[model samples]
Target: MSLQVQIMDEIKTAMRAKDTVALEALRAIKSEMLLAATASGSKEELTADDEVKLLQRLVKTRKESARIFTEQNRPDLAEPELAQVAVIEKFLPAQLSEEEVEAVVAKIIAETGASGIASMGKVMGLASAQLGGTAEGKTISAIVKKLLV
Candidate 1:
């Protein structure tokens, strides 16, 4: 099923269950997807890859906000952001563990003969493409730097 259809189904469930956190998160996802679809000169529908990227962006934004709130000693503010993150993340692909990401980075580095920080960009490009939404860019970059250096 399309992500839109899935989100709608989840929205209905959340409303029925009175899960405000999930209902809010799902609405945010729907809003973002609608904006993407209707953006001027954009295609009418997003591809699977586009949808994943959008969802990741939403999760990342909420996480960052929660971190900032925590740093400022505001658990009350941070808690909801984190709860929304949990809700949003249900739509993401299962993330690869750091160890799994490291192993993949190691293999990619070996395959490309990428040595030293000089080849970091090349390795990063390949690793990001290979891992896709399974790993975050920061995690992949850290692993690439560790393997290459």
Candidate 2:
């Protein structure tokens, strides 16, 4: 099922169950999707890649907010942001582990014969394309740096 359809179903379930946290998260996802679709000046369905990117962005945003709230000693606020993150993340593809990401980065570096940080750009582009949504960009970049250095 498309992510949007799954989200709609989940929204219904959340409403029925009176799960406010999940309902809020699901609504945010729907709103972001709508904004993204219309941002191009025409209504169009998001590609799978685009959908994944959107979901990742949402998750990242919540996580960052939670981090800030925690740093400010406000667990009361952070908890809900984290809860929302969990709800949003259900729609994302399974993420790769750091070790797996490192292995993939090593393979890419070897394949491209890229050495040193100068070639970091080359390795990163290929690795990001190969990893797609499975690995976060920051993780890929860190692994590429470690391997290249």
Candidate 3:
């Protein structure tokens, strides 16, 4: 099933189970997906990759917000963002461990014969496509930078 349909089903399940956190998160995701689809010129439905990218963006936003809230000593504000992150995480593919990501990045560098920082773009282009939905972009970028250096 499509990611959107899976999310809708989970929203219903959450409601039936009285899981408010999950229900709210799913609603927010659905809202974002609809907004993205409508905003595009073609007005086409979002592909699975699009949905994954949307979810990742949402989680990243929430994490950054939570960090900012925490730094200001406002756990009250930070808690909800963290809660939403947890719910949004459920829909994402299992994230790659640091070791796993590093391993993959190393192999990509080797396969592409990337010897220096100048080849960073080429390595990142392949990694982004291969690692999308399985790793955070920032994490992958960091790994790629470290390896390419």
Winning model by lDDT: 1
Question: lDDT of candidate 2?
Answer: 0.93
Cα lDDT tens digits for candidate 3, 5-117:
88899998999999987888899999998899989584478877888899999999999999999999999999989999999998888999989999999999989899888
Listing every candidate in turn, what is its Cα RMSD in Å to the true structure after a full C-alpha superposition?
A: 0.8, 1.0, 1.4
Count of backbone clashes, every candidate in sequence: 0, 0, 0
The C-alpha stretches of model 1 lying farther than 4 A from their native spots are none
Candidate 3 off by > 4 Å: none
Descending-lDDT candidate ranking? 1, 2, 3
User: What TM-score fits each model?
Assistant: 0.97, 0.97, 0.92
**CA displacement after TM-score superposition, residue 23 of candidate 2 (Å):** 0.5
lDDT by residue (tens digit), candidate 1, 1-149: 88899999999999999999999999999999999999999997899999999999999999999999999999999999999999989899999999999999999988988889999999999999999999999999999998888
Write candidate 2's Cα lDDT for 55-137 as tens digits: 99999999999999999999999999999999988889999999999999998888889999999999999999999999999
Q: Which 10 residues in a row give candidate 1 its minimum summed lDDT?
A: 106-115
